[model samples]
Target: MAAVFLKLDRFALRQFNTAKYAGTRIFFDPDTFESKVNEYYGERHALETEFGDRPALVQGYAPFCRHLFMPNFTGAKVSVQRITAENESLLRTRYEARRPNELPVLVRFFPSEALGGESALPVARYLDVILYSREQCLKEAQAMGEEPPLEDAPWRIISIKAQDEPYETPMQPITIMRNSLIGEGGSGVPLCRKKYAEAVAYWRERAIIT
Candidate 1:
């Protein structure tokens, strides 16, 4: 069965209507539509392809870029309670220690929403995060002995393991984003080894690991 994805944007969900579903909120066969939306958002921001050939969907809880405004991402955004100035500084330090020039974006809590459409099977919410430059992410993928990222590809979605903390830093020498779980649809788990297994088991228990 084709994967079913829930549209989590609370403000406006017009973008998720990839198939022109006559006002349909849910989407079927989201592969092409996801690619197109990611591409549109990438180009809208004039995002440079520094990492991979092009921008790819960042399927995660955080809104890594403008294209991703779903409830899951937005809900996490709302859940981020204000941190103490000292703790905030420390987290910033931890992030900057890895990426000297970049900062990590924090997202919190996953959304609890039903999949409304033909495939109403507890759909997971996906948010697209854009890693503008593919240099570091691609290199890490290669070091894992995975195929080098395709040349000049339109976009590449980076995945990571889910975490209670929604903060994400750019891919750097330590590799904030690593390649995990090679799948048939070029799928991967973006989390580090620490959380990869946990994410897999969680999804499997819920029968969401497709």
Candidate 2:
């Protein structure tokens, strides 16, 4: 099966709620999305500047879809995992300190250029959907003081990023994709970090990347 991965912040969580609770799919043009990312980067950069100006880890690429991409609402194979508040801190630590060997393929899936919101995006090629069991969905709905749906249907959280600020309340439960180290693709497009390194080395050996 084709598997895609996703990451969710607060805003993304909200969008997910809309999809599951209200049944809507929010779409954006590439330019508008890019603007939002730039605005966020500017705000974040300003705050970081106050602390101490440092070089950026990613220079040109916008940090917009660092986690997830969904190709379609239905008929897509996806894996989901939720980054809970408890593990959030640990995740941050690990992300910062991740060794090449430890880094997962998703985190290391850097594009050659920034994804400028093109229509023919990677959603079909390399995206994952978030799914939840019926029980989990009902539990979350009750927690939010909302009535759960009558049917015990599974919930598929759509792709959305959290807002610039932290979410005020606890989020509904969600899941993330499992780590996929190697997947079928073109030579330069291996699925995981180790294989990515190998591909890079292979290309360098063949004078592909100098």
By lDDT, the best candidate is 1
lDDT of 2 by residue, 94-122 (tens): 12111222332323211211222223223
Query: Could you tell me every candidate's TM-score relative to the true structure?
Result: 0.29, 0.24
Model 2 scores worst on lDDT over the 10 consecutive residues at 168-177
What is the clash tally of candidate 2? 17
TM-score of 1: 0.29
Model 1 CA deviation exceeding 4 Å by range: 1-31, 42-67, 70-126, 130-132, 153-155, 160-210
What's model 2's TM-score?
0.24
Model 2, stretches more than 4 Å misplaced?
1-123, 154-210
Tens-digit lDDT track of model 1 for 97-202:
1122233423221112212223332322433333322443354455445555544533333321112332442222122242332221112436565455555444
